[model samples]
Target: MSVAIVGVAECDLGQTGKSVLELQTQAVTRALADAGIPLSEVDGLATNGISRFSATQLADYLGIRPAWSDSTFAGGAVFEMYVARAAQAIEAGQCGTVVISYASNQRTARSRKMTGVFEEGTPEADFEEPYRPLYPISYYAMVAQRYLHTYGLGRADLAEVAVAARAKAQLNPAAWTYGKGPLTVDEVLEAPMISSPLGKLDCCLVTDGGGAIVLTSQSRGVEVLGYGESLTHTGMATAPDLLRTGAVDSGRRAFARAGLTPDEIDVVQLYDSFTISVPLGMEALGFAGAGEGLYADKPHNTGGGGLACCHPGQLGVLLLVEAVRQLRGSGGERQVPNARTALVHGTGGIFSSHATVILGVS
Candidate 1:
């Protein structure tokens, strides 16, 4: 693919009280401005989690009639999927410049329900909803449970992931947990248990935020090395393996397409909807051997992660944005020195969907 991510930005986070479209507009405008390009140049669009016609609504609200658009929904990983599709479109001459954006007021709107939203009479609703389990946390807790039991580890080990995330967040003023204080493993374990072995701190914060990215055929930005996406199931009940996610396939395809290996990558940004997600993603992406993700010595989530950073309804776009910042050497306090190639992976839909993207400079 010849496309590159030219611009990226996050809208006001933490209780902005703004509508989804308002935050999306802010993200789009700021991202395009950062790219030094006018919004008029965006002939392609991609957006989701707003409405059925997400791309159309976003284009109308942004006042751009795009020649090509995509609104594929696969949970939080959707943005990375959009980048993969947009790259294909550009390579095929279907569109020139594309703006991919997303936003949600789940915080202010108080719409974060404990139950999952499945269609009436679907298998998920019929089988799982009867249990009234917490939509995602319960499912993740089960993963954590199986992983910890298999490894002979305890909750304290999981707490390390949260603590490390908070340590990084302390360096990022944009983080909601920044300047508050540092997190300790004990603190993580002591927090109210949302599920067995999963405490409150194990989960991502409830915040209002959004992010956007501008991709173009222009070569003045980080090069689009390669990308891949995969989905295994819609509900955990149907998941083949709780410990393995779709990233195994996506990451393999991404690395093969990019002609790179994990050893050559300088930075990584894996989804952390829960502390357990880190290990799952790491193992699947070959960053760690089996049962070694939590202990793997690697540079990752330099701007804090969803754990300590802002987590709107979805976090995939912010993962891409932060990876771009790290590669561009603008991470400030959290910057990794001389970073060049970066691998970014986002997990969506209860670990059912995954996408891997490899980026490079020069």
Candidate 2:
């Protein structure tokens, strides 16, 4: 009944000009190879960003008939949720080996645009879509504004997060902003504004990339020690508290299930869709006190994260890839010292969806 991540990998990062299916194939095959398991042995598949029938389409393209498949779409949090589901299926004897993956050509195809998180005839459409505000960003920006105002913090306080992420990316050769030189607080503050306090530098990299992770109950690698997920709302219009999110609930459940606490985790890989996401995630996960995570230095986002690293639409799957590498002690120059356990948190859809996964050596 124990589930473990046997292998994890990412395909061509940056602008690959490849289709989503092509990127998905590359990531999946490479991950399978890493696990020393052939594609024929993969009877489970979980993926999205391909088509409406995400899992079904990828299964046919890979020429495999999976006994179990999942295509849950909740933005970046989907992959972590998929890991939870895949582990359950393996434990239930529904599938033996599961391959969870995701890929996006948002940068190459220039399709990373947002009107709203709602469809026609929905409450969001009637109430929030008429103003023509850029969603996701605008929603997060509103939260950022509220958070800063609530705590009497300034924009300079958030700039530290971007500077720190860029520094970490410098240590990771695979990061998009690696070797781009060191970033300064002033530079981040001076960057062109995207949505109020969040400037261009405060955002994540837009790139073409994909990643995958292979899981099994054989216990050959990092174990899925704990997991949790939550959906507070679909759109920001109905969101109750702009500063508080479901990450608190998800992270608490994960820690309680893992029999561990934030202090025990040696490494962290929270989805950094924007600079604000990091501090907010830290506070939500109890790594720091209320309104204090922004300045708290912790072992987090060693591979630059979505800010300096390649962000292919959804960054959840890649978070697992980075965490696995760190846990395996294969982090090279960016390897954390005496690292044993790692925590990964992903947020999606303007902080509407959340997932937290705790990983440790099997």
Candidate 3:
């Protein structure tokens, strides 16, 4: 049986002052409605495992009696992993229809402190967290600095990534930064530096949003051509190579399974936790040669990505929503011309984990 993404929807982007649960329910409901499938048909559910009993709590709140459920936690890439798992379940006859959702109130709740350093007794606490090297921006900054040094690239190269994302956001009215104005490379370079090479614009916004995707056995909508995931390391400090990420292995697996090449992808939706991640992902995904990733110059993150759109803690679901819209030719002004295939890549845990999915109009 072939699995397909039948529906994708995102809750209102930006700050909405809504609870995480409320956003999750709204997104799931909207996705179900978009799929034209009744809630009763949803036999499987998947979501983040942040909460100890999140799966059961969500199932009960939505009044669902799912036969199978997954609350796997892999950071921002969790949703992509969920989609891959849902497909496997359907193929194995463990479930029929599955729904994957994500919601976060990082902006409204101001939960930055919750993510501070690792737990007191964890391995990271002893060797990494004490130095504060694992904080989100700081970790990414370290990676950025290494990438820049290795590739002989400077802040200007990174600025292009932010500029491109903002340009795309200008075409997406729903984007959080849309209509505010387009971002210039100079402006991005001149912005306050959050961490050495990463200016304020280099980081993604902490917005509140939720998204959901529905998958089914019938390959009617955007078909799932292939999916792959990899976990190279748990923390940046432990990574064997700073410039290389799990995307290399995951993208290789996905493209091989789909029998497609990087050039064949009509659009790309890569997790943009920071500006440097784009070029690194491009290179790792085979879209660009090593040290030449910044010059790939392809249409990426068409919905502005987390950079100019909304990050909301986790963003894999939103990436799928945008990719589906592009494939459906419903991406409004941000639509890629004649888009037929899209490759969405999600990263987690300071470039430790990765999930890649290839989608095409069926």
Candidate 4:
């Protein structure tokens, strides 16, 4: 069965006070309304359970007791994974409409605690909890270091990605860093290093926000086209080459499932938690050849991305939302004209997990 995203919605990001539950409900309601569907019609609901409230409780609050409700946390990619799962459920006739949501208050309610101390070695130690090795910035910095050494990539090249994304962000109002246009490569390079070779601009902004999307079978809406997922490693340390990520495996599988090639994709939504993530995703998605992986002139994350656009806990959901909007000819300035096919990529599980979704207008 084919599945198409019928509606998408997101609550105001970059603020606190609204509980995760409230934000989730707001997005869900807006999505349903956008699709012209009623809450009583929802038969399935999926969301992450890491920071937010329980799905069971949220379901009750929304007055939706879905026959299929899941609270899965594969990290950032949880929302896209939910979309893939919802497609299968719909194809199996288990659910008619599935609502996937992600909401977080990273700024106010849940601030990241950074002690800058980590205890390495085995997990049996008493300080295992406090000493969690390197944080995400450090992890990506290591990857950035490897890329610089291996590919002769410079800090300026990495800054290009940020500059490009911020440029796009200026064109989008929903983007958190909008109006903050054209961040120069020099400035990015000069920015304080979050980790060796990784500057503050290289890191994603932590903001409070939530987003959600509504998916239904093709007969009821649009066709899902193809979806694929692959994990490079269980842990970040086990990754063989952080510069070139597992997005390739995931992208290839998604393309094969869709019976399409990278050339067929008109727009791409690569998970851009950091600038390096863009090249990593581009390489994996076959947008650029191996070792020659670079972003294309084709429309990519025209809505800014997690960099400029607010990347709440459920940021990947926003990617799917934008992809669907563009494919449906609804994206205004950011729309890729005549774009019939779109690729939405998500990463999670300590960068070990990667998921890709190919959507086409049927």
Candidate 2 residues lying further than 4 Å off, grouped into runs, are 113-116
Q: In every candidate, how many clashes are there? A: 0, 0, 0, 7
Error of 3 at 124 (Å): 3.2
Best by lDDT: 2
- Residue 119 of candidate 3: its Cα lDDT? 59
Candidate 1: clashing pairs of residues: none
The C-alpha RMSD of each candidate to the native structure, in angstroms, is 1.4, 1.3, 1.5, 3.0
The runs of at least 3 residues in candidate 3 whose Cα sits more than 4 Å from the true structure, single-residue gaps closed, are 113-117
Worst 10 residues of 1 by lDDT: 112-121
- Model 1 error, position 37 (Å): 0.4
The lDDT per prediction is 0.90, 0.90, 0.88, 0.78
| Candidate 1 structure quality by residue, lDDT tens digits, 1-362 | 47899999998898988999999999999999999999999999999877888898888887889999999878888888998999999999999999989888889898874233446577876777777778789989989999999988899999999999999999999999999899998889889999988999999999999899999998789888989888898777798988888999999999999999999899999889999999878889998998899997779988888999989978999999999999999999999999999999988878988999999997
Query: In model 4, where do residues sit more than 4 Å from their true spots?
Result: 50-53, 113-133, 218-220
Q: Give each model a TM-score.
A: 0.97, 0.97, 0.96, 0.92
Q: How much is the lDDT of residue 224 in candidate 1? A: 82
TM-score of 1: 0.97
